[model samples]
Target chain A: MDRLVESTRELLWERGYVGTSPRAIQQRAGAGQGSMYHHFSGKPELALAAITRTAAELRAEAERQFAAPGTAVERITAYLRRERDVLRGCPIGRLTQDPDVMADPALRRPVEETFTWLRTRLAAVLTEGRDRGELDAALDPSATASTIVAVLQGGYVLARAQNSPAAFTEAVDGALGLLSTASRTPRSG
Target chain B: MDRLVESTRELLWERGYVGTSPRAIQQRAGAGQGSMYHHFSGKPELALAAITRTAAELRAEAERQFAAPGTAVERITAYLRRERDVLRGCPIGRLTQDPDVMADPALRRPVEETFTWLRTRLAAVLTEGRDRGELDAALDPSATASTIVAVLQGGYVLARAQNSPAAFTEAVDGALGLLSTASRTPRSG
Candidate 1:
């Protein structure tokens, strides 16, 4: 069961839901058809488990930064700088491109919940920064959070498109610079 | 030949490179197998033509904004505000998530070139803004261009993940706000 779920996670990350097949999962997991069937009802059930697990892991990883002691920019910078495979892209964000995954309610639920949680959590942190005057009060927490999340996900897309991590790094630097500049200078009318 | 390539483009946008099949393209185009075969050797060849067309169209669309009379911020805002199927994601950006698309250099080249062209064009416009004293001369054109591109791509990912266009709009607003702030206020030491 564990092997089956782990294989699904890796496959989903690498090829997305549509490209991942039960047969491929089984072959990669080294589990028999019967054993795979015994563990889960079918591919969707197995994939749900994999996606749920991935979402949980993503939240936990993000929480580490959010909970860390720092100004808003520092935590976000840490979150952005956290080691990532720029070319491979975000495991959860990558699934958004898969029509099959997005089409299924059960499969889509975890994805929606995960991003919603991420955005909200980031917003909460930014709000804290605003309360403490670490961020410009003019900056909307929710909007800035959404942009931060977008920059990270979009950075992956640009990096993959260019077949280089430099694009990703440059984007992070630019966004962080913007936030840092805004934090100190505030917006001038 | 036109029908075949157009069909391939539509399928690729909807289902990605891996999910799109020659038979599906042929069916959608109402072209017979002999016609598809005569026009292209196989799926890869047809997809190349389609991707190339999409890249060309994207560049042309961007040029419309870049060529317009405006400050750098105005041009980028125009580019971002241009109507998009925010929920469907960028036609070219979506291909980055496909394992098959990324694996093939022929397929990947157009994607790479398109983004590279976009970044360079945006950077050039920003450089002009600096020269014209409309933007902070301290800003890195290449890095800022990457962030703009990333926000668009990331906006798509966030919107798709949340199953809404609100996230996309919010992200765009946030990035644009940052650029606007930067444009008006030179970085303070």
Candidate 2:
């Protein structure tokens, strides 16, 4: 049963909701149709489960970075520099490209919640940094956090488009360079 | 024939490659099977045409901003702030999420070329800016151009995930803010 969900997640990451069918999931999970149906009602149900799990795992992975000991810039940089499969794109972020997932409220919820949670979490970290004088006082934590998150998601898109990680690396470096300058400046965060 | 190509592009935007079937394109284009078949041999051929046309349109649209009179910072900001179908996502960027599109060189070429052209065009403008003393001499044009492109694509993903344009707006603002600070600073850009 757990393997079913895991397999579905992998499929969803690679193929998306429209491309991921129940038969594929069953085949990947090594489960019969009877067993698959017995476990979940249908594709959507199984996808919802898979998406929910992915969201949770993403949050947990981010928490590890956010909770690590460091100044706000250091923590944020660490989060940005956190290891990622640049070529594979993000599990949750990839769902935004899935038409069926975006069209279905039930399936979209977990994805929406995951990004919202990420932005909020990142913003909280920025706020702490600002309070601690690590970031410019005038910086908008929420906006900056959103930008950081966007750079990552967008970097994946660029990399995927080019079929190379060089563009992704450049985007990240450019963003970090800009942010580093902000931290050093005293005016207009 | 032009209508067929245009309709195919619209369906590709809404449904992606796998989801956009010949029947759907035919129906959307109001062309009979005979007409669609007469114009293009199959889905892949039609899709290639559609993607190529789309990539050209995107480049032309971007040229409007890049060619406008302004400082490098101003031009980049205008490009970022350009009007967009925020919720729908980038036509080319969205294709990166489609497996079938990414799998085929014929299909992927337009997408790859679009971004490559975009990054290159943007880099050229940045390089010119540095030469004109509108930007810091040390700024890496290629890196900054890639970053700018990333923000736009990433902004679309963030907006779609939240089902709101606010995050997208925040991200653009954040990127622009960072750029503005860099422009004002004495550091190597």
Candidate 3:
């Protein structure tokens, strides 16, 4: 059962929802068709489990950076500069490109909730920074939070498009630089 | 011939390379399988033509904003705020998520080149701004350019995830606000 879900997640990431098949998942998991059917009603159920797990994993990983000891900018920097599988792209964000995944509410909920949570969490950090006078008074937390999230998502898109991580790195550096301009104190990383 | 290419482009945008079949393209274009084969070798050939055309159209549209009369920030604002089909995502950038599109060098070239051109073009504008003293001396044109491009691409991802254009607008507004910090002269839009 575990293997089947894991295989579904991997296949979904690599081939997307439309392209992934039950046979392929079963083959990858080293399970028979009967085992897969017994575990889940069908591919949709299996995919939901996989997607939900993937979304949870993404949030936990991001929390590691957000909860780290740092100023708002520093925390964001850690999150942005954290090591990533640039070529493979964001496991959850990549699903936005999958037509079948986006069309299904059950499948799309986890993806949407993850981003909403991220934006809200990042905004709270920024709000804290502003209260502490760490960031410029002019900075808007929610909007800035959206931009920060967008940069990371967009960086993955650019990196995958070029088949290299250079673009992603450059985008991050650029965003970090712009963010620093909004900082009240002179801080170096 | 034009109809076939146009149909392929629309199918590729709607369904991606893997999901789009030649028969579907032919049916959509009102062309028979024989007619499709007569004009192109196969799906790959037809897809290349479609992708290439899409890339060209994207560049042309971006160029319209880039060439418009404005300061660096204004021009970028125009480009970012330019009306877009937020739900549909970017035609060229979306291809990056298609494993088949990224795996093939011939198919991926146009997508890669489009981004390279955008970054270079945007950098040139930023450099011009710095030279004219419209922007701060500390600004890095190349990195800033990458961030701008990333925001737009990332905005699409966010908008699609939530099935709303609000995230995209917020991201653009956030980026524009951050950019104002780098500007030498006070400007309002």
Top lDDT model: 3
Q: What TM-score applies to chain A of candidate 1?
A: 0.92
DockQ (Cα-based) for each candidate? 0.54, 0.52, 0.55
Recovered native contacts, candidate 2: 0.75
* Overall lDDT per candidate, in order of appearance: 0.88, 0.87, 0.91
DockQ of 2: 0.52
Clashing pairs in 2: B139-B189
Tell me what TM-score chain A of model 2 achieves. Answer: 0.93
Off by over 4 Å in 3: A22-39, A186-189, B21-23, B31-41, B186-189
DockQ of 3: 0.55
Note the residue pairs that clash in candidate 1.
none
Give the better candidate number (1 or 2) by lDDT. Answer: 1
Local accuracy of candidate 1 as per-residue lDDT tens digits, B1-189:
999999999898777776798889999999999988987999999999999999999999999999999888889899998989888779899888777898999999999999999999999998999888887666788888889899999999988888889889999999877776567454454
Q: Return the top candidate by TM-score.
A: 3
Which ranges in model 1 have alpha carbons more than 4 Å from their true place?
A19-39, A185-189, B18-42, B185-189
- Chain A TM value for model 3: 0.94
Native contacts recovered by candidate 3, as a share?
0.82
